[model samples]
Target: MNTLLLIEDDHRLANMVSEYLQQSGFTVQHAANGLDGLKVLQSTAPALVLLDLMLPDIDGLEVCKRIRALPGALAQTPVLMLTAKGDPMDRIVGLELGADDYLPKPFEPRELLARIRAVLRRHAPGEATEATHQTLKFGSLELDRDARSVSVRGDVCDLTAYQFDLLWVLAERAGRVLSRDQIMEAVRGRELEAFDRSIDVHMGRIRAAIEEDAKAPKRILTVRGVGYVFAKQQD
Candidate 1:
């Protein structure tokens, strides 16, 4: 079972969420404050983190920053911010700072569950199936498995860990259309419940790094109603 670390101050809310998620097949651990949540995360690395923005000791944004700074812990863990702050600016800031998804309070249980599954799907590791590719290439783009680096036209592009992983998955199966869920499974190695935009945004960043014209991308093509595909050849 996938372990989840939840940081929320409201006991009633925590209990409710813990019970519901447990019933949905996750092992949930609850912390009432940011500090306590951080401690628990340090000791036990959960598959995903559900963080409430209104923590008592520290704000959830600060907690997220601190976690990103931690040595080797949560560096790649997907964080979903749960808050009542529904402003557009708040969501943008959270995403910019690496929060995978934001769920406002008063959300439906079904929506929350979907978001959780999306996040987990994005972060879960790739399967150890015999069909998985060890390396993938497209035109001048290359994803080096041993180095975990992305190279375009033989020049290395500075990519974040998540960015590289996303590109690597897309490039490895060039021309193949992959749904958001399929891409998430290949890249994240788990399941994601809600933050599917992370994949799109990260793909945009990767294209900006490689494409000659990001505004009119030629290599990474978006299929309407479908997911995304890395074009084997430029249009």
Candidate 2:
């Protein structure tokens, strides 16, 4: 069973979510505040974290930043942010801070379950099972499918699981301009929401991690009205 840490302040909501997730075959751990959540995170090894944005002690964004700053494997752990705030900025900021996915409050349990599964699938191991440990190289950038790691020059690029997957999809189809809908379908196996900008947020994060200059990225180029394309030329 996959262990999941749920950091939520509302007791009733926490109980409901935990019961639902537990029924869905996850080992759920609950924390009522950011400090407790951080402590639990340090002590337990969860497959994923369901972080609530509004915590009594410290905000979830700070917890996310701290989580990403952790050393080794702990740092790369997938996070799915939960928020009551419907602001696009909050969702963008959460994704920018290393959240693999985000779900707003008053969400259906089924939708939440789907998001969890999608995020977990993105983080699953044996990604190169059919590729035979292949590594793609573009200039100084290196992507190892087996290890699911990306490195620019000789240094590792810090990316969340979702960001890495998004980059991989674009790089694998280098030179092709993928519309947001197409990209979302390819990456998430779902249609793009009418006004959702999560993909753009994730792309920005990916560029920041791998590009020498994110402001004028050469690797992942924006196509303005259409979408984005990963440059085929390395040099």
Candidate 3:
């Protein structure tokens, strides 16, 4: 059974969600505050976490940061945020803080369940085995799957987990162009909103990190009306 630690201060909602998830065959553990949630996570080592941004003690973002810093098998566990805040900025911040996905408050139970399943689908064991986890190189740029890290000319660069996933998707498909929607779904594990520019925003940051000069980028080339391509490396 997939164990999920759900952290939410709203007792009624927590109970409802916990019961619903349990019915869906998930082993659900509930926490009423961020600190307790973190403690549960450390002790129980759940498969995933469902975190609410508002909590009685410490905010969910802090909990996420602490989890990201945790040593051993817990560090890479995916977190799916549940927040009353529906703003795009809030969602982006959650993603930056290592959240795998976010479901706004007033969410339908069905939608929440779907998001949980999607998260599991994306990170489940044997999923990425479709391609070997070996490092891939394009000129001076190297993507190290084993390290879950990237480097440009031997210098490791910082990237948000989302950013790293996006770069990896494009790099692995080097020379093949991917549409914005396709890229968004592959990287974010969700479809993009009509007005959402989150993918573009992430792409810009990625170019800044890897391109010699983000302003005059030759790689990550833009193809108007289509999308961006991880421009093929030249010998």
Highest lDDT: give the candidate number.
2
Q: Rate the local accuracy (lDDT) of all candidates.
A: 0.76, 0.87, 0.80
Clashing pairs in 2: none
Error of 3 at 211 (Å): 5.5
Q: Output the lDDT of residue 86, model 1.
A: 51
TM-score of 3: 0.79
TM-score-better candidate, 1 vs 2: 2
lDDT of 3 by residue, 8-97 (tens): 999999999999999999999989998889899998999899999888889888888888888976887889888775576777777766
The residue-by-residue lDDT of candidate 1 on 69-175, one tens digit each, is 77763666778889784565555556556676778887777778788887676555555445654666666777766556677888977555556667777877888
Candidates 2 and 3, the one with greater lDDT? 2
TM-score, one value per model = 0.66, 0.95, 0.79
TM-score of 2: 0.95
Ranking by lDDT: 2, 3, 1
